[model samples]
Target: MSDATSLLTVLVTSPRLPAGLMSRDAWTALEAAERVLASDLEDPLPAAIEVSGITVTALPYDSPAEAARALVDATRSGSVLWVGSPDADPGLTDALAEELTRLDEPPQIEVLVGSWDLPGARLLDAVAVMDALRSPGGCPWDAEQTHESLAKYLLEEAHETVEAIETGDTEHVAEELGDVLLQVLFHARIAADEDPGFDIDDVAGALVEKLIRRHPHVFGDGDASTPDEVERSWEQIKATEKADRDEDDLLAGIPVSLSPLLIAEKVLTRAARRDIQLTYDDKADLGTRLLALVAEARAAGTSADAALRAVLRQIARPATD
Candidate 1:
């Protein structure tokens, strides 16, 4: 049996602030700690805890070995050491454990979580649940889903999300958005099964890279004061990025799978960008006339596809008394 005086309890807490966000147990631990240590000297956690009259010490160590040595020395005085956000340096805890084991009278190490994760932090839990559902010995339906098989669901969820937004129902919009996000997660999980598989992190990293690349005004040396200038800059950047891919044809990048109206609008916009005028004679077919209307809608700054969808929705509404 270990003596109470020889034991060292390290309270690990999250660094997120707004003191009310911390748990009561975390607050109690902070209040009781003889010495609080953090890896980052400039981190706001130390200042936040100091607001309540508790002094926090910054661990003067650059590496795991140094940190472990410092922690061991501090704990020899029978002082409870509080480690803020050990997740930042997980190796430090392991090193500390290893170092403690070598000592003949090793202090009884106790790890206590001082703070709980916030609400939005549970998004990671969603990803974990998805992984489990797609893993072997998991749900039959989830395991069978592929990018091709889930395409229809993605389209349906996107339409449902649009409808929820149009209806001005915040709760319904949130639920529909979640469904749309589920489709993204599902597709990413499916891709993870392939030999050269990529996960959601790859998806997110690509998106972040694209966003930064496209928004040169925000991330780089490009200048764009107005929204129109921003849009122009974005298109210019995109054109440069896709220069290797069918650069000869402006419409080459347009997806063939897009709806007829969107395809028409895209074709017209691409042609107009190249200063190629399109005109339909009186002898032109109905398809030509439809394309002319799509061009007209684009000139009026309206989405031809969205305009048709709105009209279709109006026509399909149920009759009222």
Candidate 2:
């Protein structure tokens, strides 16, 4: 009978990343093991391991139980490493546990993480799914969609996100935000097909550049301690970037199709940024009074658009009667 005090190292790796891209600790474990075993010879990890001149034995077993027993038996000789499958070697861990329970003194098992998914790694999956949907054999609706056709959805998703936020349902807000993100991805994909040179990467790169350029306090040596100071700095940097455009047109880029309240808010903000004092009559028309109210909301550090939405939501609630 072989010794039962041997070591069994189960190595796990993130499928999202490249197969050979393992941590130093994981590589050390792999090198230290007397024997390496894998269930599949065709797996990327096993192939990658073999490239490094480490001989990997592919287990010829009918079930996970049989595989677990074989691996445990191998460990009796010396330290063994098991290369986990991409699907996390389903049922293998439990099977190993059950097999070990039957042993008088089972081999000590250690799970080693070979690789980890970085932040925003799942975004690659989203891009892949979107690409498939827009491809030749994928969804008919998605394939037929254009930027112009999907324009309404962008607005709808944005409104739904706002509504979800107002409702204070975190899950609903997340779902709605996902919808908004889908619009962005969809448009980017459409642009890739139509424009040929631009894609989601371009959009992301431009956004990153803009963010770094605007937030001088965070990314540069410029000073901006408070929120107001940051806002002013951002506007100053933005104005400098757009210095080629008409300097007199403070509201040039503000979308005219936005709601009157939103437009008023943006107009007032631009005017304040440019030090242009906007005068309003105390006893003015309804529109002028509403604009003044927007200005007042801005001064109070609240959003006029969000306040009206909250009130409208309360009024639109189901009748108790």
Candidate 3:
């Protein structure tokens, strides 16, 4: 190697991604290097590099200090590239730094990120953890959970997430959101173990398909300039999707499991969308009054369920002297 090209390159790649998937710079550095070394030749990245017709020499050093000395010695003669271990080659970088300081003319050392994790990569970790917990000889409590048994926890997590958002603590909200996600992953894992055709991927795929189908303005050429127009478009798309169900009933598809306030809001919204005027008598019962309050809250663009929850929280607070 020439004077300018004589260097030590520490190449790191994301273990989560395929070994051969690397940046152009990484491949260029590998091609330019006089020697490419790895502690283990059988490791995925080294093996992949070998398949690409690049010679990857295995360093036989038993310790990081010894490996560091060998790397520095190689770099002094010519350009040398060290493939980082999946476990981050613990203590190797520190050992290299110490070794370099003792030398009068150490080769220029630089860390190169060959590959990085993409967005939502940590979701893979969540899936793996859920699988492990539910697997045999794993967590006994997690192993015993079923969808039906875990349903209440899902509802609780959602409510907690709502409360966390209301408090305006972003960190708390994120934590609560994680709890909600855990329920989803847990249920998906259960389904995967028992139901052959269903998994988290199926759930996510259906959601993605539904989002694309519904948002015609965004995904297709359909025109919807305003939020109201977009919402109307969604309702129309949903109606068409549910054409096999009873089309005559305006509230046919609204989930019955929702809180009474939310149920009332959905019913009122559905009725308004259909241009069906619904009225209550002057001598309306308590249920009718509650429904009317929900409608009032909806008209004011607020949640009656949240309003009631806030008042209850206030009442439950310990009195200050």
Q: TM-score for all predictions?
A: 0.62, 0.88, 0.88
**Which ranges in model 2 have alpha carbons more than 4 Å from their true place?**
60-70, 102-104, 318-321
For candidate 2, lDDT tens digit of each residue in 45-124? 99999999888999867788998989998988999999998878778989999998998888899999999999999888
Positional deviation of 269 in candidate 1, in angstroms? 2.5
Compute the lDDT of residue 5 as modeled in candidate 1.
Answer: 67
In model 2, residue pairs whose N, Cα or C atoms come closer than 3 Å (at least 3 residues apart or on different chains), thus clashing, are none
Task: Give candidate 3 misplaced runs (Cα > 4 Å).
Answer: 1-6, 60-70, 102-104, 248-251, 280-283, 318-321
> What is the descending TM-score order?
2, 3, 1
**What lDDT does the true structure give each of the candidates?**
0.76, 0.89, 0.89
Q: Candidates ranked by lDDT, best first?
A: 2, 3, 1
Model 3 global lDDT (CA atoms, 0 to 1): 0.89
Cα error, candidate 2, residue 181 (Å): 2.0
Of the two candidates 1 and 3, the one with more favorable lDDT, higher being better, is 3
